[model samples]
Target: MAAGTLYTYPENWRAFKAQIAAQYSGAALKVASTTPAFTFGQTNRTPAFLQNFPLGKVPAYQGDDGFCLFESNAIAHYLSNEALRGATPQAAAQVLQWVSFADSEIIPPASTWVFPTLGIMQFNKQATEQAKEDVKRALTVLNQHLNTRTFLVGERISLADITVVCSMLWLYKQVLEPSFRQPYNNVNRWFITCINQPQFKVVLGEVKLCEKMAQFDAKKFAEMQPKKEAAPKKEKAPKEAAKPQEKKEKKKEEKKEEKKPAPEEDMDDCDAALAAEPKSKDPFAHLPKSTFVMIEFKRKYSNEDTLAVAIPHFWDNFDKEGYSIWYSQYKYSDELTLTFKSCNLITGMFQRLDKLRKNAFASVILFGTDNNSSISGIWVFRGQELAFPVTDWQIDYESYDWRKLDSDSEECKTMVKEYFAWEGDFKHVGKAFNQGKIFK
Candidate 1:
């Protein structure tokens, strides 16, 4: 029998653990609940319980080997390897990538945007707006990438898709109304496909799409209020009694005089005067053309030593408005070379820059080749200069240069701008990287 027991509340914490349980149905993974039936603080916080998992957080795991793990992602990873590492190394790597992406990219905004709107989390109008924008931007990235592909990381369903889909469950259940999701047709399609998977269906039994909650409807509600009393109608006088027939004939004569057309000379003069007026130039003609730049990085990663140090520095000093970061990987090679180790590495880089959480946003993409096997894209920052400090992991100063391109340079500017606007071909690199191990 498998040696570990997983403990978590039923619905709140189930999704994260569900991925593993679904993958490893018979893998001796006992789920201990801390819900109403088995309260954590009320009854399960005994020394024995504390010893097994000190954090007291639901979803903690205690292994038969006596190893305890906290954090959903960590436990899910362990369970997944033992339960569902797939038939090949490449499949395993894709799973890791998607799982990391879910934790990093999806959860943050979900916590920030969806929860608040649902009243599950405190609502701050300003914060919610920002969160909405962030999520929209992130989803846009995902939708574009998903335009051509099916799963989060590869052709097949893996832990990555499972993880991300689980995180999104809450949004679908509470916030993704048809109005909101209509713009994200691809995301909706991919989500539907994922939820329909046998394992996903088993884990998320009878999951239903939620109707969007109206933000506020006080005015409309008020307008629908019933009137206290009926309004009195005003009486009208009879037409025959109101005016005499002779007076009506005189009124008709006056109307006839008014109906006579002005002379042709007067009409022609009016047309001539109107035709003399000058046309105005378009108001927006002089507006400065927006410029963009695409900074491509395509170096090979043999070991962590060369690029590890530089990535963090670049993230720290990265210019937020002047540049945008799109995490890119060779698509096909991504499912191949992307291992749990690499996923953790990417996650670490993102975490190191966590301080820029609000100031800057980042995303990842998986492209399908290895020769130009570039994990590269553009950063649309606010200024002409690349203000962000280069990290030790970065190859060389010359390798990553940011420049202002001609607005007319469609080829260069559009791709970079698309990365920022969350438009174009790159798929959403999942959010798992956001929570994965970060370099100090």
Candidate 2:
């Protein structure tokens, strides 16, 4: 069995391939991603790390016996057992073919389609549309191939499945909503099957499929730009002193060249930019400090009974003067198809509004069955103003119609009780409660 340490950043899908392979093969693989072991830019750029992995890109690997490898495919291949590599020469060749396909075919379009949504790349409408078509084409090919097969290569899971799944992970999670993925049923089934396996699950925890397709957020994109450093003041030396200084600098440069290290290579421009980016100012910093604690309510809602305990706590502690209640309903309910997809819309919205959770609490629910449903939710915000209009939480808010509710009104109380409890008759929605997701 191969025993080694893998160096990479956390949640890096590329590193997942080798980790999953190691799990299946029972290889003793140690990950060095966190502090003290490895830190992305600092650790990877170190002289010791660059000596082993010259390019400094990851997921790089170094074995106990001194064998070292870079490039995700190479590392995964090295870590795989014969069963994962292939059972025969032809099987191994086929595995290589699929791995190459994942790199050449899936990655480009996947990165282009998914990066902008991640706020790592600038959005270009024309380029994004093309990437969508390209992704569809790739999925169509996989769908056809997987129509009669459970796995990609043989009767069992192999490196081929791992590579392709990792390559498509971001795509499935960010853009491949149910409607867009409906045509590629076989691909969807195979992808789901692969991810659910013990090996894949060990590497990738619960993989939530995209409910609503993500869009490039101009606010998030702008926030990712590196903070500009102030330019240093320039000082000029005397005309005669300049020549002696230049010769001294040339001598210093020549001596330094003798011990020069490997050139630092840029890998994943977005990752580098994100590391250098500054923390954003809190959007709700100007709001008055409310006595209501959003986290405490969320904790009770999660752990305690909703109707008997959590609901009462919400009503008792809700600061009417400091906080405001609002009702939001999806404007395009007619376009919502699958129930799961509708739920995904709620999930996606909650994810985008993560920053708002400190000052907000919401019960966004999906109503009715597949092909016939409505989405409506009760939102509690720290201030009277519409939070989304004034904050960066505007990504999905425009998709829903918002109305400020009178906190003292009986109608508002009923809506809050039902939404928070997730069981009351939603007469306003006119549909049965299918599922609910909370944002706090």
Candidate 3:
């Protein structure tokens, strides 16, 4: 009976809950995503949006009668039929329990693990492994609960089933490969059943699970974040007390040494650095290409043994005279606010350095959350000299401070092992680990 308009990002699993609810209830739910209805980021920032949904997070619903709702669960419950919600008080509480379980028990680790694979956020291997285990446990519980029943609550499909299925949406599609998920047989069966329902199928067209789990793509994650225009450099305020002779000397020096790029060219260089270009080709053109395939090493690091085998193999077969190891850290940690935003900035920087990826390996980490975070990375690139110079990457390269890491030192060995494995106590920053973005 709840007729309204819903505003949320496309393919958002949260919004899918409300949409599926509307489909079953025969409610008039107009989705406002593009053009005359709504434009994300722009419209959501407007006064009207804030007035209706004070929280401003999506799956926001506003009915013609002026009833407004925020949060997916609230919007979903508002739109559902009495049968779906539950006919009795006890059943309704039971439905609410599953919904709460999904939000609290499932989402935290799910977002940490799957968001990176979707290129929405960064990855932390330790956090991801913990998430995989946490998810398996949650599914084990659900699988046991669903082993007998066809639906989560009662005999028919209910809001509990819809909420839990949508909650598992991204995990199944992004990180839950068959081999990883084979243990949760009943959970998989329930998920397929819930999604195949007419209402669910209408909102969620088709569900595709990962064949072989995809690792983080630093380039894609960085490029996916909305681009922020570089703020113009503010000219320093004139020194009110400077003598006439001093001003004249400064002006003369500025003319002699201050050759600034044109505004268009400045932007062009920054853009070109990230974009593919014909300016430079084959950075290793001077040296013979190493017979040791970097890809094989990467596969080993990703899937096979890392510290025990891969790193040793890397050193054993390393083109030591050709490749060099370097430690790189963001110089603007003081400017990073919000853990998520800081991670995104690092991702963007790595994306801008995509050309160097083939020549490089890095594990950049964010140390804290909002206003207290720092970004530092360990990089191993194809050449002895920094790979960014005389190339497109130089535009963003200046933003970082780089130090050559000695590949021979025991300390360097530890750093490479810890950072590359995405585990171990990171002794560098001396803070609890937050998350990491891989520049592979």
TM-score of each: 0.46, 0.55, 0.56
Q: Quick one: ranking by TM-score, best first?
A: 3, 2, 1
Better of 2 and 3 by TM-score: 3
The 10-residue segment with the lowest total lDDT in model 1: 294-303
Model 3 spans > 4 angstroms off: 226-440
Put down candidate 1 lDDT per residue, 198-273, tens digits, no spaces.
7667667777897764352334423322223333444466665577789879977877776553321211111222
lDDT of 1 at 334: 35
Cα lDDT tens digits for candidate 3, 1-440: 66779987667788899999889888899998665687555466578899887755676899989999988899999999998899899999999999988986788668778877766654555557767877888989998998898888999988999999989898888888999889888888888888888899988998887788878887987775435445455567677765689877997677655444322211111232333234366657787677667766765665556678778888788777778888877788788776645655765676666566567777777776667767777887787888878455674677789999888898788888777766666677635334443222
The most accurate candidate by TM-score is 3
State residue 98's C-alpha deviation in candidate 3, in Å: 0.5
Tell me the spans in candidate 1 whose CA falls farther than 4 Å from its real position.
1-3, 13-15, 19-21, 34-37, 81-91, 214-440
Select the stronger candidate by TM-score from 1 and 3: 3
lDDT of 3 at 299: 56
lDDT of 3 at 124: 53
Best by lDDT: 2
Q: Model 3 clash pairs? A: 338-370
